[model samples]
Target: FHDFLSVLLCGHKIQAKLSSNDKKLLPFLASYLCAVAPEFKPFITFTEDTLKNFDAVIATGSNNTATYFDHYFSKYPHIIRKNRNAVAIITGKETPKQMQSLADDVYRYFGLGCRNVSKIYIPQQYNLDHFFNGMYAWKQVINNHKYINNYDYNKAVYLMSDIKLFDNEFMLLKEDTGYSSPISVVFYERYKDINDVKAQLEDQKQNIQCIVSLEDVPFGVAQTPALSDYADGVDTIDFLIKL
Candidate 1:
């Protein structure tokens, strides 16, 4: 949000869609922008009312919330974003540095961003040592108070149950088929054929934000996205330019 807002502060943006909670710092950020430029706030509105007072919209939310946005904003020229996660297709041959770099995609933003690598696709009977070694640099993240709380909670739940998990004293790895993993927990799956997995991912392109591999995108570069890297592959500038 800050990225787009900062760009618009050059005195050209018109409107934005924000929730009620998004305006908490409106006074501060807006005041700061006003100090930076005199005519900046005229084109901005921080309202939560559902009124058709804008030319277009960009709505982002979870998959569940996207249903409501699609229905309510169906008449508007809008881009509704749903829950999407990034994945890493590991071939079990990455160097130690590459593995450690991959850890950035997982631990960055505390595994909360859509670009975070929540699920990793590995080959059948893949070695786990390399995966563990790559994430060693971020092992210190476990010391965070909030992170350790979640870690302890998930570890206890998996322990009392019979779920087989791999624990390296910080993050927990579970062999699951799901893409969205909880904090301190990452889900992984085994794939025998890379082409088959690619086909499956292609079929569900709308459900994914990005795919990270050595050949595709370098590790640790997910969060530091380029301006052209539009979310959901919908060109925001193109839409506005057409408008």
Candidate 2:
């Protein structure tokens, strides 16, 4: 929605159909936006049929929803999106400050946003003490009832299933190949070579939103995307210009 908000500035008529699940929070959000930008009030509507005549479409959601959007809107000029997650590459050489920043990037939004780092790649045989120490700063996140509930539940399930886990009270670190981890958990994989990790990431590029490391988007700042840093690496402005 933030990206498409620019469409209005370009003098294009823009409206959105709110999904059934998003109704809980989107109405309040729309009301707040309308309060500040009255011109935006009319562009939001609850009726799905109101968007039947749109010239172009921008759809974002899970993979299943993306499939449905592509099927329905394929005839139109559209940018349908699937879920994408950010990841971090951790070298053993990071300073404590950088580690802390990475922790903030992972925990800032309680690891819910697509830009949040849901996984990390660490060097083989790397000591995790530094990482755990950095994460201590966000230990207070356990105070959130919802977050702690997830933490406790996932921890118990993992323990009962005999899955090895690294527990930090508030977060669980699991070794897994997946990108999207459960709430309060961060999936991880060990890398013997950095180039191998890079190759795997390239192979799975469509599933990844951003790479956080010293060489890529930095340790922290994944959620703090610049206006031009388009989602899924698709340049919306360029798409608009071409259209």
Candidate 3:
């Protein structure tokens, strides 16, 4: 809801369709919207036929939904579809203070946003104590959630079954073969040379969004994103303008 409001404030007329489960929150949210921006009366229901009336469509969803959007909306002149994603930073010389600040990027919004850092690429010799200590603040939040409980339970079951996966409160399960988004998880690879690391990152470039690294390069920043940042392999305005 806040995300939509942010975009709408930027001069966009958003036509939102809430999932059936989210319908209960619509009336309250609508009332709030009316108070803030009376011109924006968001609709609650939608049908397939109604979608054709739009000049352009911007669909934000999972890889499955991206596939569906591609099949159904590709015939249209303008369509922008995005897959789920997140961001992470790599720091070889991270101090305790830096790690603490980095925790904000990882745990904010329950690590749900596409820009959240789901994985960190750190040197093999990095101190785990500093990283975990920084993230300790999230323990209570993770314990109070039902979804995190399910993930932890499933993680334990997988461990008992000798299934290899990552495990933690905020994130777990790495080495996944396909698209990984949300639910923070880190995958590590050892490199003997800088060229090897560069080659590996280049190979996975298509699947990557922001790369947080200490290396001085054109897109390698500490923990911030520019306004022009693109996500999930698509441009935001390009997608919106097409629609």
lDDT of each: 0.82, 0.86, 0.55
The better candidate by lDDT, 1 or 3, is: 1
TM-score-better candidate, 2 vs 3: 2
Question: What tens-digit string does per-residue lDDT give for candidate 3 at 31-136?
Answer: 7767787667653323323454554455656667778877877766534435433434344566666566666666666656555555555456655666677666
- Give the least accurate 10-residue stretch of model 2, judged by summed lDDT: 2-11
Per-residue lDDT of model 2, residues 1-243, tens digit only:
665455655556666677675656656776888899998866765556657667788888899989998998889888888999999999898999889989888998788888899999999999999998988888999999999999999999999999999987788999999999998999999999999999999999999999999899988799898888889988777666666
On TM-score, the candidate that comes out on top is 2
In candidate 2, which residue pairs get closer than 3 Å at backbone N, Cα or C atoms, i.e. clash?
none
lDDT of 3: 0.55
Candidate closest to the true structure, highest lDDT? 2
List the candidate numbers ranked by lDDT, top first. 2, 1, 3
Cand. 1 Cα-lDDT: 0.82
**TM-score for each candidate, following the candidate numbering:** 0.88, 0.90, 0.70
Ranking by TM-score: 2, 1, 3
Candidate 1 lDDT tens digits, 1-243: 643563373434545555554666655677787788868767666545655566566778988999998998888887888999998899877889989999999999899899999989999989988999999999999889999999999999999998999999999999887789999999998999989879888998887889888767788897777877888888776666565
Q: What TM-score would candidate 3 get against the native?
A: 0.70
Worst 10 residues of 3 by lDDT: 214-223
- Tell me which of candidates 1 and 3 scores higher on TM-score: 1
Candidate 2's TM-score: 0.90
